[model samples]
Target: MRNNLISGLIFSFFLGMSWLTKADLYDATLAYQNEEFTLAFSKFSRLAQLGNADAMYNLGVMYLYGQGTEQSAANAFAWFSLAKEFGIAEAFQTAQLVLQQSNDQSGLKDFLKLQKSRLSNTYLLDSTLTKLKQHSTTPTLSKTHDVLPEYPDEAVRQGIEGWVWLEFDIDQSGKATNIEVIDSYPRHVFTASLLNAVEKWRYTGSKQAHTLIYHFATHKDEQYRETLAIQKKAYEKQLRQNIDAAERGVAQVQYYIANWLSMKEYNAYQLLRYHWRSDEPMNELYLAAAKNGLDLAQYRLATQLINAGAHQLGVLWLEHAAQTMDIAKYRLATVLLNTGEPQDVPHALQVLIEASNNGHLRATLLLVNTYLTRLSDKAQAKAWLRHGLIIDPEHPELLLLLARLAENQAEAKKLASQALKSASQRNWSSHAIHLFLQKLAN
Candidate 1:
């Protein structure tokens, strides 16, 4: 019996050794790290479909970098989620980062819920187990041996299809514990489904907290995928055209593209500030465009400079742009207002008055607020508002301001009602006006 046991152990050891190595997977990983992304992507994708966790993780990275496929945050997220479940140790962290870069938390949550729903508890692939068995450091799903939930009868009866967010903790023993709901529309319906599934879900790793989504639906989620594909293709084509036009100096394209690049940089600041490096400087584009006397470019450059604390240079740009652009004059007034002197106030107010006279509603509103606060001048506020009313009488915000100036309570109420009704009908309620109306109501 002892000799037979020893022989069995030796056979298992040889089997494990044979199963562990894959020349194609190793080559793919090497290529990925060496920045031969296209070649790496092909190999990794092929292996990922074979249920290789490492290949799945690499595929996620490739998608994130736009190496072989179109740069798709959604695809990256999906691949990483698969990798994480299949026992890739670092895939979870990478997936979270990919989602953050996508800049759509609500949409991502929905996507994840749908993904979770599509995954079957009974669906353990032999290939995934083979890959996972080779990496002992990687965590395994807790072998709790639980059943996957069936489609709820109530869900079908009322045509109810939605998602629920669930939070759970993996304990020191690699068991999923303390499951609870975070958010769900029509809460009680999906709670049982989540709780029952989680009861048998386990993880074999260090303690970790996770929030997952479970979405219910009647049909395949092909519509959203199709829409995203169309948008991505359109954006890419437009981007290439814009880049060509900007480089060739095709009329207003230079300034327009420069301004767009500036906005992109601003949006990316938080994400790229710490570690992500970029050689593309939108400042050079802005400078070139401003030198060519692009009024919009000058204004944007001035705003950028002011934000970076270069006040004197920014003011010059603002002043130059303000010579032709009414909006620039309004923005110049805003910059001048921070100069900390009584003389600056008069000049700023004058610039604002000019902009307001030129049909800038925001400038007019700012003038109204300033006049009402500084000089307590009801006449000036009325005059400023009248200019906007001439342009657009049914402008809900201006109507709301007029209500604030009403002589009697009944007049105020009538004006307020008119503005609210108009705003509701038109979907044009600005946050500033909304807050002001709320305050006046209180």
Candidate 2:
């Protein structure tokens, strides 16, 4: 009778512990939903290390956002893969996204192998043993897994999988302008899929065209094999040749610094500063240029000084530059914001408004947020939010904030529901939705 009583007490204690864990997880989820990512990250990471698959998935998301830790796609992949091994569907999707962003396939393969091995050992007492074994046997090849789509002929193998490297030119609009395979392994079968996948890739827009390289690999059988090695080699050669040709096309921009140093041309000082590295020599050059009364050079020197945290000295140069250059005004505004002095806010706001009007998205977002949330000016905030919606309707923060601003409860609920749906699609935190569902059920 005493043994039975002791056993009952032990069971009750365990049950209570289980409930506490679940409650912690629920709280973490709520924090994540509210974008209190730091708290969410700490809670999720603790639970994850304790072997909670759901918590592992959430922790991976926090890493992706740089919440409690630095943003690391590799760490995110490792945690997501760990959760994926436990058969978490969300983790599986997140693992795939992390893999897509990763440039290192070998690292991912190592991580996946480690996770599988760990799971195999753990699952001896778990019901997921069979599923884990099945995952081990399946080939890592599918439409969703293949992010880059280009390969070399030699690396294309009809029945094998290996890595392929390719270089492509991305235009200012973020579209692939030209693609050429640099190298591949198991060359025959890999090239076709690589090319097909790469053609669909989109990049964030930049001011100038940029060159990028991607490495990808997959497993497939002979039916999809396509030989493109010779073609790839020839294309790479042509790309190099084009680069060499372009060097000859711009004589003024090329070696402009060398010419400026010899001629001591103050006008060429501004142009030279553009390509200068952040070193002592560059600093000396900038000082000389600033002394020569070049406003652009003064602005560049001020930026360097600000970055080095010599705020007082930087401000002196910036004030001089601001007399003639709009860029100097923008830089001064940024410095003021970072310093957080009450006296600087008005000037910062003025310069930020100018920059926003000139179509700087960063300045625009900052300005809008300041008006809406910080300053508490609802009318101005609403106007800014409406303008931002027109510019970027799909921005998550804006959508969520708008939902919160709805006049009636029904309207608020409807907008929140829609925003939550969109957030789910982006795999953003879903704690709020879960809570809302719980409330409805109760």
- Cα lDDT tens digits, model 2, 290-312, are 43234555565455455455566
Best by TM-score: 1
Model 2 weakest 10-residue run by lDDT: 249-258
Candidate 1 TM-score versus the reference? 0.39
lDDT of each: 0.58, 0.52
lDDT (Cα, tens digit) per residue for candidate 1, span 106-147: 776677667555543212322222222333332324554455
Decoy 2 TM-score against native:
0.33
Residue pairs that clash (backbone atoms under 3 angstroms), model 1: 142-202, 142-203
